[model samples]
Target: MEKKQFLYMLKLVPELLDEKNWTERETAIIGEHFCALEKLIEEDKLIMAGRTQNKDDTTFGIAILQVDTEEEARYLMENDPAVAKKVMTAELFPYKVALYNPRFTI
Candidate 1:
């Protein structure tokens, strides 16, 4: 039962130069998005996910996903609160896990 998986890069909406500070509403949306991602991880759909740490740039997040097809990966991204709420946009790509520690296997 080896299903093909994909790697998706989720890019957050670029912060406005004038609006450098993140509003409370934006913070809330990100929090909810993380919660949703946590649930996906628990369900074994997401192998790993994390955000970029570049504070002075257009920071984005990356996720390793397990799905039956690329279409499913697109659907998952579209349904994510971050994307749905306009906090982020995503692009999916077929990927192969060439090397990794067994403890990190999905």
Candidate 2:
């Protein structure tokens, strides 16, 4: 099957913005989240993942992925460590990469 592109937008829980609210468990989950995304990149399932620098309500992160079906896309999004543990909420969307800049690096 051919893979399709998808993206998941992630919003951090408001409480997480305050460093004082960070517990060891919460910090661990975030570490796991990064590991998971890194694994996806190794698998060639992830195109890119990044977030805004702002520390406000408007802040968000996005993960772009290529997978075989919408179900797979949704599964990846829901299974993201941050989302699964409720540190972040995520919404999935079908996406297309209309252009690329070869020099760009995250």
Query: In order, what lDDT does every prediction score?
Result: 0.80, 0.95
> Top TM-score: which candidate number?
2
How do all models score by TM-score?
Answer: 0.83, 0.95
Where in model 2 is the C-alpha error above 4 Å? none
Collision pairs in model 1: none
Measured by TM-score, how close is model 1 to the native structure?
0.83
Q: Per-residue error at 41 for model 2, in Å?
A: 0.7
lDDT of 1 by residue, 1-106 (tens): 6777888888867662224657888788889889988998888888888978775457778888887778888888888888889877888889877786878543
The lowest-lDDT stretch of 10 consecutive residues in candidate 1 is: 12-21
On residues 17-62, what C-alpha lDDT tens digit does candidate 2 reach at each position?
A: 8788999999999999999999999999999999999987899999
